[model samples]
Target: MSRPIMSKATALKISRAQFDINKIRFFDFLNYKFRFLFFCWFDLPCYFISKGQYNFAARVACTELSSYAAMYFLARWNFKPTLFVFLLPFAILRLGLMIGNWGQHALVDDVDPDSDFRSSVTLIDVPSNRFYLNDGYHTSHHLNPLRHWRDHPHAFLTAKDRYSNEGALVFQIIDYLEITYRLSTKNYIYLARQLVLIGSQVGMSQEELAAMLRLKTRKFSEKEIAIELKK
Candidate 1:
């Protein structure tokens, strides 16, 4: 027997319906938090697996296992205890990166999930793109996922107008710490103020935008929210 396949429209309908239901129950807050955590921990492995990159996954697993073994031996014989203690901050920094991934794409456009420009934010403040290799131009990277990172800025510049029209969110003078801190503190108003006409493009009134930005508010019913989104 063949398995049933859902059409794109059907999938989108179901997704929208679920979005509405989550809004009604005020479950989106918890859902986003949980998704944020899951993405941090498992997104890379799961993405590789989903793309049938089994060899990549195997290599990563082996590399991680070998690193663990090396660390164990280093602590047991070669490394001083204080050196290991000093490395703890680096471990915490890695953990923080997991949460940072969540902040990057947290405010995806409701009407354009697959639109690269609308679905991700671009971080513009970092002095140099050397460490991240211009990945701060996220929408450009998304538009051409396999393109060389060095080419991202060109891609972004080439299509700057379209991105602006689509209401793509860009942080002109903010760093990762600012993004993470604002989100952690539920400072949505401040964050929303930074958005470029997203409220108007999404047909969200000021009040509705505020309500949507809040972490735990359900001022609109699921039907109403869905209607507004469809607009």
Candidate 2:
């Protein structure tokens, strides 16, 4: 059966929201900065590894791998033993996830660049004000996190859009891992752990640290969590 398309109304709503978010001071700049920086960072290394300058391919790998890492470490607190037990398996899994993501980059070439895209769900980013749901199962997981794999399509159908073939595979990996994490841990604590991990790695500045910690913002809010999910 053919997949349902995003209705014009839904698309317009999502697009407008995206535009609104894109116009946000912090998110607009932050999104572009990270997207470009990571695109260059990963793309260059991938070139050395792939022996060619397939920059677009590298960017997609970077996006997928980063998304997978976010989903993985954000969800599960489990640790795998390394040469140093204290070292934990998160690093190894993150590396493996990136390599796996690089392999999956091959599939991006299979997609039509002109393919229309829209997200059914919406996120209000108080940070950059950029609305995002490019890989949307993250949104689905947030909405009905208790739902399992085989049951997802039923839930997804309720949403106005679904991923194309290539997008589905990437989303599935992240979604499954996310679900597993939801089943194993409390969402807020998991989020806090993820915040600390990302904060430490990025050498978060005071402003960025305050933003992530919401120290200036007060109690954690779902709306805030939704914004973080998009990042």
Candidate 3:
């Protein structure tokens, strides 16, 4: 079967443009960038929908449903319907997995999409690296895409000095969700404290960073505020 082909350069260009456009809104950016779950659950389907590719979206939806049905049937064969309720938690778990990617890449410099170190966040602690199979060393993974997961730590360690010099955002204790919550709550000061200073390199100012982190308040004309208050 013949398949569509796109060059790496073309794909990167599209991806970068999409990231730039989506980063204008926090939730939109999260949806566009995070795809760390069962493949078609959210992002892939949403991407198709956004592009008006309804046939592709429907195929993805059907595939997900089929997978769930297969699991349900397999479980049902071994357990009672009441016991099948135990599987409910897996659905919630999937949602959590979907959110995981957002936290990993959230604070990285999307402005320089071409540079892996600048575009990805790295988690330094042991627990995250072990649990995720060194997925926490994301910049390393991007730098060496075909390297074994077990080799990520070594690769990251070798380049640790360079990453630090480049102002890569490295979180020791916290995960992505915590960062997301803080940003969502308009805790800009805390976020600022955690940020690695890549603004100078990226041509992003502290004020611009602050604006990006501040989500709760929206600027409005006096007339608009009065109208909203009335409603």
**Which candidate leads in TM-score?**
1
Better of 1 and 2 by lDDT: 1
> By the lDDT metric, which is better: model 2 or model 3?
3
TM-score of 3: 0.54
What value does the lDDT take at residue 21 in candidate 1?
25
Tell me how many residue pairs clash in candidate 1.
0
* lDDT (tens digit, per residue) of candidate 2 on 30-67: 44334433454454455345545465456657766776
Q: Per-residue CA lDDT of candidate 3, range 1-231, in tens?
A: 111122222224323333432234665545543443344456556666765878777887787778777776868687655344646566566667545644444443434434566556677664766686776676776676567878877887788778867756555555666765664466666665555554342565656656654421233334533433343
lDDT of 3: 0.55
RMSD of each: 8.8, 21.6, 10.4
After superposing candidate 3, which stretches have Cα over 4 Å from the reference?
A: 1-66, 72-87, 108-110, 195-231
In Å, residue 211's CA in model 2 sits off its true spot by 47
Which one is best on lDDT?
Answer: 3
Query: Predictions ranked by TM-score, top down?
Result: 1, 3, 2
